[model samples]
Target: AARIIVIQKRAAGKKWGKIMVQWHPLLTTSIPVEQPKGQGIKDLWEDIRLPGEGYYFREQRFGNPGQTSMKLTERVIIAFSNPDDVILDPFLGSGTTAVACKRLNRHYIGFEISPEYCKIAKARLLAEKTLWD
Candidate 1:
């Protein structure tokens, strides 16, 4: 449906990087003012040439073999989009994209080829700790 695609390096030695995002209809990326002091989303793509750390779950990361790092995904989502924006992930691996979207208050539609991965991703999303008290 929608499309908000982001291509990133898998790692330093890896021959190929990963195409991580895909949005629906049409999505626009805008740089906003009033950010966290010196740090702004403007610098989000500054180090795009480097390798992504992949998911933060480490040993806990399962189901999908190619899980993008949570921090990297979150950073991209925060920079390229705003809260309430919709994200589309065609290859919904470990659901890192969905997790990032949820944490950032963005809507998402994730598609996965494997039902097993889907279930695993769902559990991970539900297991996420809320920011609210």
Candidate 2:
């Protein structure tokens, strides 16, 4: 599946993110599974709105310029991985990937170069942990 992020700002081109599926033939058994009915996800997603500077600006305040919506991250995670699967995120901006992994019962390793974003990611993960406790 592919998600195209359309920003509302003028002159901003559409941003693209994709889930790349790879497996060694005869060695890997991973395959995409069917999502439950009425999950609102499609092969081509065009309806998920980007967080703007209005009511949805709460997520953008973390100073991660490349922040994405949690819904999008969750959908991608669900499509690509199974419960308890280990996922690796090279850029852990704001901890969206980790939070989604926690919510979906997956283990994740995330790396961020900026200390500020690292702090934000840890806080977000902690918040998610407390939610289930």
Which candidate's lDDT is highest? 2
TM-score of every candidate relative to the true structure:
0.59, 0.64
lDDT for 113 in candidate 1 is 89
Task: Give one digit per residue, the lDDT tens place, for model 1 in 7-58.
Answer: 4444433334665432112143554434566665443243433244432344
lDDT of 2 by residue, 1-133 (tens): 3343232321223445733222111122344556678364344444444443333433445777777778767867887688999989999988999999999999999999999999999988887853458
True-structure RMSD for candidate 2 = 8.9
- Cα displacement (angstroms), candidate 1, residue 85, comes to 0.8
Query: Which runs in model 2 stand beyond 4 Å of their true positions?
Result: 1-31, 37-41, 51-60, 130-132
For all candidates in order, the CA lDDT equals: 0.65, 0.66
